[model samples]
Target: MKPALFYLIFFGILSGLLGCKKDHVENVPPGQDWTYDPTPFEIKAPASFPILNIPVGNPTTVEGVKLGRMLYYDPVLHSDSLRACASCHSQERSFTSDPPVLPHVNLAWNTSFLWNGKVEGALEDIMLFEVKEFFKTDLEKLQNHQDYPKLFYEAFGARTITHELCAKALSQFQRTLISGKSKYDRVLEGTNWVFLTDEELNGFDIFFTEKGDCFHCHGGILFTDNSFHNNALDASPEPARSAITSNPADVGKFKSPTLRNIELTGPYMHDGRYETLEEVVDFYSEGLKTSETVDPLMKSLHLGGKHLTTQEKSDLIAFLKSLTDTAFIADTALASPFH
Candidate 1:
């Protein structure tokens, strides 16, 4: 063939091959793409906080956190439609309700979850329990919903929502609930121009010293060691950690919840036995009920407790209140999307 004619035929074949690629795009339904890549969301935490161990398979994304926040507040997750994760965990109360419900703040650092440590491991592990065992979420409702299908698709690259995906999404949001802006944290940073009162300072001393004996389990950046302990709440308390461990020594042991928002997360302790911070102080001061499972850290059990004086009790309570991070409880991002 002549040079011009040969060139035309070769170019025509190349054009035809390109046309085939366009056919696949044409075959796809409107607005539907085969590839799904959500935007990565970086979690912000304080300098003193430990590095988060996010699951490789379930990284936090902007879309995932948004979906998770909605799921967290929506009552639709429950079969009765009368309760939501937010029902027991309210933001105003530092994501906690009356006792047995712990605050959600700084959960990213926790290895054990729940009052009794029934679930342990990553945040996703506890979230799975929340989705499957706690909520018993019906996938059919989510699949049929007008918003969830699209939300799931954008968040997880899947239109079919499953319990596992639900758990992962919830975990993403929970991981972002960092609470490190309290007065105590400000004092630690030494840059926020915030200082504790004389009473709070005295209480801090008591808390860190053997006088209060609180630091043994409640110390750390997160204000909790994330371990189970039988704090001598009762001589014969109900089975707690034992239920999960099946060990007699574990009985009456409960997880040490974060005190980041201790002022707001009241009805204190595993059973909500104490109504006020004063009562909680009084119990540790002189009312400890010793038992076989009492934590060794409760060294003052022989003396009937810490025997904190009336002024000391007041000061200790003042210090715990210093941990209330107003910024965390009022963050609009963590609040209910519906609200």
Candidate 2:
């Protein structure tokens, strides 16, 4: 069925399920009705996935995830109702902005948020910034929305519509965005998966070896060491990590995003300059910018790039595409619940 039709039907059934009569919790709040579901919010991930670093105060809950899913797709978060967090961070692109902007995959493991590591409080801090600073959401409208206030009440009983609730619910839903069904994952687990082509194998070797030297930062199940570095985007100073720290030594340093879905998350780099995977690979292969903060992994400052052959670059690109998780992007649970 078409996704829109499916979404409408699915949510129709969900609304019926949510309509079941239940004993309302006895909240002492004068005029507030409080209800909290005990449904466990199990994060679907492989057994090999690392332990989730969820904040103690904000454990995942069913109502929270439902509210968050709505908030994510709700254009009501923006004053003009023309954009949403999902307007930029779309599920089709693995919760990343369409610009090949840094994605929002596997963020429970991330210690910081955004392409720049400046925001250090919590993942909710990102929502606080996106709604308040970046997009300027009309909270009054959100509170007065047909369903948002009700959903917020369901998620956080007695708490009126606030940015904090928005962030918390959004964070709950985001933490559930686990992408471990890629071919790379299956192959690594020694499953009876499709065998890698020799070109892809060679590319993998190149990626891990000193020749490609990509593993240091982009390695493991998450595909990121989750650190800030100047990957030599340009020689001129760019407002990067330093914009947060104001440390001159941190100039041009930006957080290294995961390469899990690298195939689709282009144009590559902090500025979204490169348009294609070929351009990105070719840049790392021959167009490394010499910068004071350039990552030491780039190696041999005089040599602009990794200097991979054309065929090697092609193979590398193939290996990178292997990381794409078609199932993750198509997950109905992650789709817009409002549709």
Candidate 3:
């Protein structure tokens, strides 16, 4: 061959390779941008609750949140293909199951997932460790199949699921699960779609008053202290905080949950004992079972015997209903992606 022709052919191939590289670079999606819209509703956090501290490494991003949402609703993470995180933490009930009905008798409707509020860690931790363990599958199988390892690389800059990346993605997705725009929120925002009846207003007053004493633990936009407390619900004299910390006094304590959608997220309390809010109120009013580690806050209120007038009880329920955010429940963004 002529030297000039051979040189031209080599250079042509090199140019083609360079052009292909450029196209590949162009086609790749950019890293996620972390900013999210925070204006729809002011979180209205109570003075007692601190600003929720999110981790620094996994900044909130649209892409990361989307990926987390996909993972959240995907049952692929489960071993037998039976459960997704959503199976227990259902979106319809504020990311909690209403109540599981077993064979012979109906189980009390408690909040979802692990019994002891042990799943309070980052969502990624729950998904990777807790969930994967539940399925009892091998780690390699999880990493190799389903393109999950590739997804981890894309969402987070890692090829494998590190605890930090998983937590970041899960937390980012959770932060997006905001439950604003309830009837109570509307009333707070001065909307006229529905007016609070006088009785409900009275119930609201009672809820905030010393007589009810409910506000101490359940005050704030999220309606939780965000601190662990022992409500003395356990049958055995077990120390709650001991599990999280070996401190003797810490036993029997559990984290308080948000009351945003309380009516739907029943039967009430840590153990799911109360079927009705009325039962819950009555317990607080009178059923203060004494225990060595009982919360100092749980003093006899002389409430149940006095009896909330039927109208007052109804009003209190109405106020609780006001906490339910219908818009959140039906949000397409949070729905199961598999469907």
Candidate 4:
């Protein structure tokens, strides 16, 4: 062969092998980096409740959060046009609906979120599911709408409402709904401006004491363990865990919600059985109905007998009120973008 041709052919063969080697290297799995930008809103998050793990595709951004806020308040997502995400998870109420009802008992309980606690999924997933449940519609159906496809294209670089974008937008918006600047937090941070009266101090003692024993499940900054437990409120011993795991031992278990804004997120419990803080204290104090699945932590609390003196109860309530962050409920950044 000619020297030039021979060199060309040799180099070409070597290049082919190098190309194959490069392709093989590329095929190897790369390490997964799940980090994303944290929510921009300011709040007093516990170290335990570390920045929520946002999915890789849907990162937190001011524009994306704005789009999510718009979607959250849009009534068109509902079948009846009467409800929006904000309708059920109102900002004023710490994103939970109040005044829960029991069908068989004709009883009204201070409810949190939907009638049942079944809606306690991830904020993004819940938003997507609500839309689907309302109209039996998915992103495909949404794409056929007059302006939805266009909106999606603008928000997510696509003309279709994929589950990824739906979840991302909603999650970004919900993350902005943090509420941490309460009077209680100020007291904890050693701000003398929030002066707790003697009654309030007494109530605080009771809350952490053996008589109240509320700290077991409601401990930590969020005031919830973020785990599920059965407090023995089952009427028929139905298996609650069957829905998720089909395990008999998991029956009647429910997630513990945060008590940051408990005053607004009332009719407490998974069923919204208690209406007031006093009623809730009384339940722990004197009204614990026993069952096989009762949480081991829930010993019968005397609440220092008589469910605390009236003054003590009032003080406890005052402490709970200190947990409410008025600034969070009125944050313009979280409000409907349309407004």
Each prediction's TM-score against the native?
Answer: 0.90, 0.87, 0.74, 0.72
Clashes of each: 0, 0, 8, 6
For candidate 4, give the lDDT. 0.61
| lDDT of candidates 1 onward, in order | 0.88, 0.81, 0.61, 0.61
Pairs clashing in candidate 4?
97-113, 99-111, 100-111, 110-266, 110-267, 111-267
> Which candidate model has the greater TM-score, 3 or 4?
3
> Which candidate number has the best TM-score?
1
lDDT, residue 211, model 3: 54
Q: What ranking of all candidate models by TM-score puts the best one first?
A: 1, 2, 3, 4
Q: Tens-digit lDDT track for model 4 on 1-339?
A: 899999999999999999988887786423122223344533234343445555555666755676677777877666566677777667667666755321110001112223224555455555556556654434554666665565555556554476667657766666666666777777777777676667767767767776566678777676766566776564454565446656666677776666677777788876676888878866655566656676777766222233566676777677677777888778786676674
Error of 2 at 188 (Å): 1.3
Q: Which candidate comes out best when scored by lDDT?
A: 1
Q: List candidate 3 stretches off by more than 4 Å.
A: 1-52, 98-139, 146-150, 232-238, 301-307
Two-way lDDT contest, 1 vs 2, winner: 1
The 10-residue segment with the lowest total lDDT in model 1: 28-37
Please give the ranking of all candidate structures by lDDT, highest first, separated by commas. 1, 2, 4, 3
Predicted candidate 2 versus true structure: per-residue lDDT over 1-339, tens digit per residue: 899999999999887766643223233332345455536687777887888777887888898899898888888888788887788888888878656567978887887777778577667787677778777877889866766776777777735788777889889988888888888888888888577789889989988888898888897778898888888878785979988888888888888899988876777788788889898888888787787878787784579887889899999988998899999999999899875
